[model samples]
Target: MLDATLKTQLKAYLEKVVQPIEIVASLNDSAKSQELQALLQDIVQLSDKITLREQGDAKRAPSFTIQRAGTDIGVTFAGIPMGHEFTSLVLALLQVGGHTIKLDDAVIEQIRNLDGDYEFETFVSLSCHNCPEVVQALNAMSVINPRIKVTTIDGGVFPKEVEDRQIMAVPMMFLNGEHFGQGRTSVEEILSRLDSNAGVRAAAELSKKDVFDVLVIGGGPAGAASSIYAARKGIRTGVLAERFGGQVLDTLAIENFISVKETEGPKFAAALEEHVKAYDVDIMNLQRAVKLIPGKIAEVHTASGAVLKAKTVILSTGARWREINVPGEKEYRNHGVAYCPHCDGPLFKGKRVAVVGGGNSGVEAAIDLAGVVQHVTLIEYGTELRADAVLQRKLRSLPNVQIIMSAQTTEINGDGQKVTSLSYTDRSSGAAHKIDLEGVFVQIGLVPNTEWLKGTIALSRFGEIEIDARGQTSVPGVFAAGDCTTVPFKQIVIAVGAGATAALSAFDHLIRSGDEEPQTTETKQAVAV
Candidate 1:
């Protein structure tokens, strides 16, 4: 067993790369196995093509398409597979390469008694930051049955291939190469897939996850609202999220947060978190649901090795920042350029900054940075800014926020250390200019948090989940709300409303079935209704 100090250090060391065991082994024999250690590094660098890149490819996928790599052999991770997560990745690779996690006799028995091997694959993206668990749970399922190969690919780095295969979300999976699934799933349901062999090919397209008594997929405003509704309704509710508060956590201010009218994003998110915590719902943090198997009882497999069974499932795993799709743009993200300007823009205070794209996000970021930086250059690839007229006027009004129209950012210029500047071409002028910048905010657009839903749920052409007015997907039991879902608006209030609708609908479903119990007076009084 590792000592406490060693364990802590090990945990910190894991933040850097995959293969923690190998790192430990190399450090142990660094002096004696110097050549071998060097060889390992080379192998990690050269053979780490978990996903393929066409000769002309530029950026990674919406994130890595942690699918297509195939059961372990071509294992590709959509996100940074580090931290405690490395162990899960290793185990998955070992199993795919032919190995298994030593399960207790009881667990192993469950595996043996399992009717068959239900293969699963989870695609993920590194920027997702919440997708690691989806990768782990699928691996655990694979270990139960080696024949049940669970392939994971990086989605950010392989857009075309995953798109060609029709990948719409991360933590996506395909069972038996035909019945595909997404979001998250429990081992029991995974086994059911093997036993039933239902959606092998039908999974290639998107569809909603299996419904349950309660399905709260997001931990954001909408998700919290739904969870509160279901729990108060006496519905056995469960929630899964990439993180709580969804995109709300990325916002710097909540000038419009209810009751208080104003609050910081994280602060409001924490408040919402506390409220969610006040309920009986099962909430998992830093945990992601990778696949959802539609069946009698929906199974949810968390990256943290916990399997939850719910009568209904809700999806609110919100949106992530859009990218520049440049070659090194990804490799150096957070290293210099960033997404949540609130979290990272301050790092470049007093430094020259450039905001790419002309969308509201980009323009708004430029305006926000004008006061903090010496120079703020807002570059728009289109002929005009797509941001709202107010935002365009505000961006142009900032003396420091320079607007460049008819421009396309070609590459993010950087040194081996950090970002140095950006290179873009003025399409109309046929001129290219390089601006020295300490940071580049690529606000091209927002990619719906629906990539993982590709194979499992139906998605709108714009990449949002397709939900009815009641927030129901094509699948009966599953429901979605938030920026990830295909509702008309992407605002926080809209998402909250969607969550409420989903919860009420799911509650009606449970009551109609009579499988769920009725609510007590106290439970009824708990909700705002």
Candidate 2:
């Protein structure tokens, strides 16, 4: 149930609807449609301009179409609008009701000139924080062009469809019947993917090789810092990143970074990119590296079959949150199990939630959720919490937060649809316990993103790239930094410093090896790294 403040806000938003918006519900099962109908009725009651129309004899159990001005607008939601997806539904209604779509002039023209009929089907888990952005963007595009049919599916509700498509992650996009991509994607990127066959053919025909003086494998703080340092030396530097922000994008608030009192992760990432672009570094975003070939000139191959060559390579590919393997963990993801607390915490507002792990991340997530959720049960497998003293103290101060020690999570018990409870074993007493909750947030630890460097580079036992004091790897010209390397502590400031040191080391190597043009008698200025 929504609070009074949220209800007031929703009412205010609905009152701004310009054109009459109609909700066409295809009802096959009355039991399944009750919640959806109630939600629609509540929304319609807020504004006289909105109404709902039920259509019988539809095959779909719970599907709805939003129409305005007698046009379908090609927007549909296959499941009940709840969780993080509620924002998507609300934004779609506003966009069709006359909200100005914020897009580039070229992008708007491209949407207006769309060539063929494209059905944009977005499969998302309700708990995914990044899912709503993609869904809302496509929905707005649908309003811009009638040919772009947009359909949103709840991955948790329609597990059969997700399985048929072999979708392992949320925010998975599909054009027509072909799988487009997974994760958060921009509107421009989706438009480029409309003609998938032609795009692939064009990419294959233009097999070009790009050579750089120093190539950074990631685009996070470490990679951005390295590229900036290398570019300052007047050398050709480039960075290839999957999303250009790394793990920082998922973070909600960051106060540890020096000089800045407080900032959000996405904002900090954008600032990092702007600073890096201030130099002459070439940034390649949305490129996933699949393989690394070590040699005199190291070669990096992307998922798109593109090859990049560099005299020296810097590996800063960051880490990701590790998954706690247990029964029903993957099956009920986004239904009642979530990974990002800051992103999905609001969805479980006024509801009980469980947090796994006892480290800094786990304790921090518990503290963060304690303010939003009604109660938080933190389960730790270790004897005591491994969080910092300050974090532990803060967590103890929370009245609604409870921490369980030496508890090994055995299984995630769910009702085949959403998580109802979680089962764990007390290692000391050899007893099992289960807690009833609406959501579970896993915050065990981080896993390095160095799997592609298995045979090409020397790695530590934990799959981290082995680096020395100067950030140089075992290979002659190869270097590493950030969480992907054997860094003692994974922090933003430390990664940035590591990146700078690696770039300076690389420049020193190039100078000593006489790779750059020899200094002339007329110019005596030394090259700065």
Candidate 3:
């Protein structure tokens, strides 16, 4: 080991010469060069990391605590954090650290009262700068809660550590020792996870199994609200959804929703999730309802190979985004390429952004981004913008917004750090043009969130589960509403209304079937003195 004197001597000597030339010659000196390289290698190791992975109180199972030093809840990134992943992490931290999003004051107050610690150690390669947003969001969330901490481990330097953790991608997070959800989870979703973990699964599982007063089939807006309302009615309610929030989670934004006007689809979905959890409703997310045998006790078959018995079913299966299937689009989503500008546009503030498709959503995204970002590039495969005339006129009025009609997205350009630009082919010119931008939002349209329910429920020609005005399906005891349903227009207000209607209608059905004996799984009762 070099003594302090030798280290000072080396520093002095190195300061006098240009680094590159000196490094080459000094490295020629076998012993010293080997020593220098070894020292650098060691310094990069986790043990020598300037910042450390957090260790919470350990007592808090459902929540984690953050370690704070000052105003800035010190976060250290060993590598460049520049892409969508980094942005998300930052946002998550901001929310966790008391950064309020575009939510109402009431919602903000409710979230502010939440306290927990989170530590995310995302494994990333030097080439994956596009993933910085995830870290950034996490850090932002940490700021909301002083207990949250997010760290990044350079995969290039620590492949063994990543392998030991079984990390298969550029990004992953672990809460305590157990693996949490994957990909990019919104701040609200992460909070929901913490909340869900707080509820004892066994205690929550103690719902009545024999006879449900109300049965909610879907897990979207309508189903979530329906179950909540019904359960709040002091009646037995059971909810089974492929996933909670149904197609609402699939939505990119809910600006059209009354009173909200602007919010991310996932964040908005999380707000609804908070409402769902505020009640004693039985939730079965990520389980599809395959078949429904409507009768006194409707037997619903699930994709997980489990049969569920409910009194009435509310189907809120949502829709899926229709993809262009172009190469690199899926791989680059949220990595510089995105589908929801509302969810990601803020990251590109004063930076360049892009939007694909000629529909209203695309046009609106472009317009929305134009105001916040430095440049807005719009791509459409058609000869002209297909949005309404007013939107077209406004788009034309914006100097930063470029309209590229008849140009189809052919390829996305990136070094895998983040998307640097996009390449498109112009049918009229038989040529292609590449423009540098930070993001790409696709607005081609979406598939009804009802594909998995083929034999389970009646579906319309558009793949929407058919529903009545009261959100009831063809099956007497089953109901559905929202984007996945046969609602002509998929809007936030409409979905909320449909969800409320389904809840009320399901409650009424349960009341009408009073002949059936009710059941309870509760064993605890007060002693009659």
Highest-scoring model, TM-score: 2
Please give the lDDT score for candidate 2.
0.83
Which one is best on lDDT?
Answer: 2
RMSD of each: 13.9, 7.2, 14.6
Q: State the displacement of the C-alpha of residue 11, model 3, in Å, after optimal TM-score superposition.
A: 46
Q: Over 4 Å off in model 1, which ranges?
A: 1-212, 429-431, 517-528
Candidate 1 per-residue C-alpha lDDT over 87-190 given as tens digits, one digit per residue, 9 for 90 to 100: 55545545443344454465455565666555555655543333454566566655454545555555433445554564433345666676365543444444
Each model's TM-score? 0.58, 0.72, 0.58
**Backbone collision tally, model 2:** 0
Off by over 4 Å in 2: 1-146, 149-183, 188-194, 198-206, 518-529
lDDT of 2 by residue, 437-473 (tens): 9789999999999999898889999999999999999
Q: Candidate 3, TM-score vs. the true structure? A: 0.58
Write down the lDDT of every candidate, Cα atoms only.
0.62, 0.83, 0.61
Stronger candidate by TM-score (1 vs 2) = 2
